[model samples]
Target: MGIRMIHHICIQTEKYTESLDFYTRILGFEVVSETANFHNREYNTWLKIGDFMIELQTPKAGDKFNVWSSLNGGPVHMGFLVDSVEEEYERIVELGYKDFKVKNGKIVYEVEGESLFKIKAPEGTEIEIRDTDIK
Candidate 1:
């Protein structure tokens, strides 16, 4: 048996438009397909970058888990590997986002000599940005 790379990551969000904007405009994920009222969802959007895809869905109205809340054993957060964490961090900051952790006026944080940073997604999910060459 062999294992391959991640196919996609699914995110449920009530802020459909905002999340779409965040992924498409800010993060630069191209929209592969967007369907309204797909499989009981208000919207089901498939966004892609390189070989990875992000499946974003909006739940039906009045759904309990429609809001951004931890699933108590679901994924804690998601991350993306980038060429340069510093460049990505600066680009995000230039977009007028202020959801990153800062210490000593620096948004990038070092862990065990690795350069990385975290930014909150529109739905409050922590998206970690890491250097591609990190070991």
Candidate 2:
């Protein structure tokens, strides 16, 4: 029950190259570190945006072994803070990201009872975007 703080957020994607580019180029996060996964013979990289860190990992290939990420309870989904939720929503759609909606049970944004909206990245990852509210 000692869930005090989040150390890092991990994302597992088969399209590691695409995901990395989306985070670094599209979202403008910087690569702080990277290393090789000796066990799986893949690449592991870390990107930073402000105070948050994201770990991008690739799944093992040619495998018949039971290897899994520690984040197995759920797949990768990330949230991004924007200056304007509506504006970002439009921009994301214009950039070809689809499935954008705001009807769900999730973090409540401090904008007159409106919660956050959701969208999908290129590799089918859920990305939630909300206005720039600390809460």
Regions of candidate 2 where Cα sits further than 4 Å from its true position: 1-4, 64-76, 99-112, 132-135
Highest TM-score scorer: 1
> What lDDT does the true structure give each of the candidates?
0.83, 0.68
Report residue 55 deviation for candidate 1 (angstroms).
0.7
lDDT of 1 by residue, 1-135 (tens): 777888999888888898898888778999999999887789999999999999998877668563455565778777889889888988887987777756567778787888888777787777888986644
Q: What TM-score does structure 2 among the candidates reach?
A: 0.66
On lDDT, the candidate that comes out on top is 1
lDDT of 2 at 125: 66
Instruction: For each of the candidates, give the backbone clash count.
Output: 0, 0
Model 1 — which ten-residue stretch has the worst lDDT?
64-73
Candidate 1 global CA lDDT score? 0.83
- 77-102: candidate 2 lDDT, tens digit per residue: 67777888777666766766455434
